[model samples]
Target: MYNLLLKEVRLGVNPFFFVLPLITGALMLVPGWLYFIVPLYFCMITIPNIFGGYKSQNDLMFTSMLPVNKKNVVQAKVLLIVLLEVLHVVTAMIYGKISLSLYPHLHYIFFKPTPGFWGLTLVMLALFNLFFISMYFKTAYKYGAATLVASTVAVLFAVEAEWLGIQNQFVSDLFKGSGSTDGLTHYSILFTGVLIFAAFTFIAYRIAYQRFKKVEV
Candidate 1:
């Protein structure tokens, strides 16, 4: 499982992905900026390309030739996806810190990506991963259409959510405010988000396993 995960990471995750957070982090210096959009952008641009490439390259066929179970292969792919998400979030957080330090007077309208925001991001990504993995594997290797559809739906949902938040006062408040890094609510939300992400990820893994099991390649 570990070896499979490493292979996926090497093949799918790349330096461009790592640089994305850093580039977006720099944008945080702009006052009242919506930093959360950074992660969303990362998802929209990269997830489809990476996963779609995997399908086009017949990654499953190559991996299946090895002495690994289909379930483990699926699990490894999911794990690699989760790891990439983590990398994105952590790098953004570090960038947030640097941005704040450089511009102390900057006023952020949205929650400055506290623990709660990260939790929210995790939940969003987990939901996306579940859909992307489940749908892509059903075709047994045709990711282009699946990826395009999934990415479109995910981007539209995110845009609509942001639009609604802008128009609704209560919804806007949910994402507003800034505070010190120490807080119980922040930690609680972070933990809860992690659990939710784990649950959804496990669900995705099961779906992938069942779909991949019947794949002829």
Candidate 2:
């Protein structure tokens, strides 16, 4: 299992992806931008490229030649995906803090780059992985439909949330309003979102494992 994971790190994922967080996370520094879309773009660009490389490399066929089983292959790949997602979120958070420092009084038409906002980003990514990874691993080749459906759902979540934030003052205040008392509630929502993302990834891995087991190569 360790060897397979190393293979995934060394060969499965592109070296370019390692630095992509730095690139995409910079978007958080853009003042008054829709910050939620930074992580979404990370998913949109990286995931498809990762799987596209897999198909072009005939990675499934090549990996099947090795000693590892399908479950471990799936597990290692999913683990890599999770790691990348974490990288994206953490880097974006740092830039978000910098954004706050630079523009302390900036008003937002959409959600602020708060911990709660990242919590919501995690939920969006969870929906994306629930659809993208599970469906992509079903064949280990085709990812277009999976990517489209997953990306659409994630994008729509952000767009609609922004719409709600704009149209509803309560929602806007909930996301962007200043309230010292609501910090606890904000963190609680963040924690719950993390838990939900973990659950979703677990289920996605299990389903992908079973699905990949049946693929010929």
Candidate 3:
């Protein structure tokens, strides 16, 4: 299982992608921006391209020739995706800290790149993975429809959250308004959201694994 994941890091995923999430992370430097989109951007671009690399390199065929079973392949690949997603979030969080420092008085209709916001970002990506990986593996190579639909769903989640944050004064205060600096109380929601995100993504991984295991390749 570890070796299979190493294959993805060493060959399946392009070196450029390891650096690519930083581009999305760099969005945090843009003060007052919709910081939530940074991680979503990571999903929007990274996931499809990683799968594309797999096809271009004939990864499915090559891996099938190995001694590993389909379940381990699915596990390693899903794990690779999860690791990359986490990297994107951590990188963006660092930049988010910088953005806060750069603009201590900044404000936005969208949620700033707070820990809580990253939690929501995780959920959005979870939805994307639930749709994208499961649907893509059903055919094992066709990712276009899956990517399109999944990305759209993730975007809709962000848009709805932003819309609500804009209209609901109390919610806005919690994430984007004055309540931001309220310390532990302000971050309680963020921690809970992260935990929820973890649960959902774990479930999504199981669903994707089961679906992929049924594929002939």
Candidate 4:
């Protein structure tokens, strides 16, 4: 499993993706920007490109020919996705801190780049993994439909969350107003988001493994 993950990091993924976090994360410096788009870049660019490469390089066939089982293959891929998502969000979080420091008094119309906001980003990515993994495993080669559907789910989540944050006073207070100032609340949201992410990924893995098992490849 470790070696498979290493293979994914060193070979399966593109070099550009390694530095993409740096590029996208820098956008967090833009004060009061729609920070969700920072993480959304991964859903828009990385997943499709990485999976497209896998398909073009005949990765499914090659990996299937190896000693590893389909479950491990799916697990490694899902882990890689999770790792990349962390890279993107963590980098953005760092930059977000810098932004917060730079503009201490800036008012935000959207969600602040707080731990809670990053937590919400994790949830969005979690939904992406759930849809993408399950659908991709249906063929284990074709990813267009999986990517489209999953990306849509993620976008919808971001939009709805932002909308609620804007329109709902309690929601706004929790993420943007006084609630944002409360360490316990924001951290709790972050913790809950992490748990949700784990649960969603586990479910995605189970569904993907089952689907991959049925694939002729």
Candidate 5:
């Protein structure tokens, strides 16, 4: 399982995508910019590119030739996706810190990233990953349509959530009112979001394993 994961990480993911977190993270320095958009863009570009490329290259055929089980293959792919998401969030956090240090005055415009944002971002990414992994594996050989649909759906949901004032309620309060980290009820939401993401990711893994197991290649 570990070897299969390493293989996928080494062969499937582009290095450029890895650095994207850092690039997005640096956007925190921009005055009056929405920092959340950085991570959203990270998800938009990376997930589709990696999974879509795997399907385009017929990666299952080559991978099946190796000794790994279909379950491990699915697990490895999901693990890599999770790892990438973690990388993006951590890098963005670090960049947010640096941005504040460099321009203290601009800090007032940008609320310090709290646990609430992290929790919400996790939910967002997990929701997208569930759709992306499930759809991509359904037709592993033809990723173009699946990738487009999944990516579009994820982006639209995120955009709509922001536009509808769902994602911003906490942030808005933090910036406009006396919302403190201690006062926010993010831990419960964060815990719940983590559990939901884990459940959905597990479902996605199972779907991938089943689909890949039936593929002739």
Candidate 6:
């Protein structure tokens, strides 16, 4: 499992992707900007390009021939995806903290980079994984449709969440107003998002594993 995961990190994924989080995370430094786009970059750019690499390299066929079961192949691949997603979010959160300190008095028109906001980001990516993983392993090679559908769902969620932060007074207070700074409220939201993320990703993995078992490759 470790070696397969290493193969994913070393040979399967490009070196550039490792640096991408830093570039995208820097966007958090932009004062009072719509910060959701920071994590969305993973869904938009990272997943497609990385999975495209897998397809072009014939990763499914190559790995299947290496004496490993379909389960480990799927597990390593999914683990790599989760790792990248977490890296993106954690780096962005650091930048988010810096952004807050940089402009302590800045008024945000969009959701602030609070724990609750990061929580929502986790849920957004969870939804992406649920759609993308389950659909991708239908063939375990072609990823275009999976990436398209999943990314669309993620974007829609971000849009709706942001809209709620704007249009709904309670949500506004919770995410942007005084409630934003309340540790209990924001942390609770973050915790719930974490649970949802774990559950959704696990479900995605199970579904993808079952689908991949039937694939000829």
Shift in Å, residue 199, candidate 5: 2.1
Q: State in Å the error of residue 65, model 6.
A: 1.2
List model 4 lDDT by residue over 76-190, tens digit each. Answer: 9989999998898889989999998998888889999888998898899899999999999999899999999999999999999999999999999888887788888888989
The numbered model that scores best in lDDT is 6
Arranged by lDDT, best first = 6, 4, 2, 3, 1, 5
Which residues of candidate 4, in runs, are more than 4 Å off? none
Cα lDDT, all candidates: 0.71, 0.86, 0.80, 0.92, 0.71, 0.94
Model 1 spans with C-alpha error above 4 angstroms: 12-15, 103-105, 160-164, 168-171, 178-182
- Which ranges of candidate 6 are over 4 A from the true structure? none
Error of 4 at 177 (Å): 1.9
Pick by TM-score: which candidate is best?
A: 6
On lDDT, who's better, 4 or 5?
Answer: 4
Candidate 3 Cα deviation (angstroms), residue 177 = 1.6
Badly placed stretches (over 4 Å) of model 3 are none
Clashes of each: 0, 0, 0, 0, 0, 0
Compose the digit string of candidate 6's lDDT tens values, residues 1-217: 8899998999999999999999999999999899999999999999999999998998887887787788998899899999999999999999999998998877778999999999999999999999999999999999999999999999999999999989999998888888788999889989999999999999999999999989886
The alpha-carbon deviation from the true structure for residue 10 of candidate 2, after best TM-score superposition, in angstroms, is 1.3
Q: What is candidate 2's TM-score against the reference?
A: 0.95
Supply the TM-score for candidate 6: 0.99
Clashing pairs in 5: none
Residue 184, candidate 1: how far off, in angstroms? Answer: 2.5
Question: How do the predictions measure up, each by TM-score?
Answer: 0.83, 0.95, 0.93, 0.97, 0.82, 0.99
lDDT of 4 at 24: 94
Q: Of the candidates numbered 4 and 5, which has the greater TM-score value?
A: 4
- The 10 consecutive residues of candidate 3 with the worst lDDT sum are 185-194
Residue 32, model 4: lDDT of 88
lDDT of 3: 0.80
For residues 17-52, what per-residue lDDT tens digits would candidate 5 score against the true structure? 888888878887776566667777756678768867
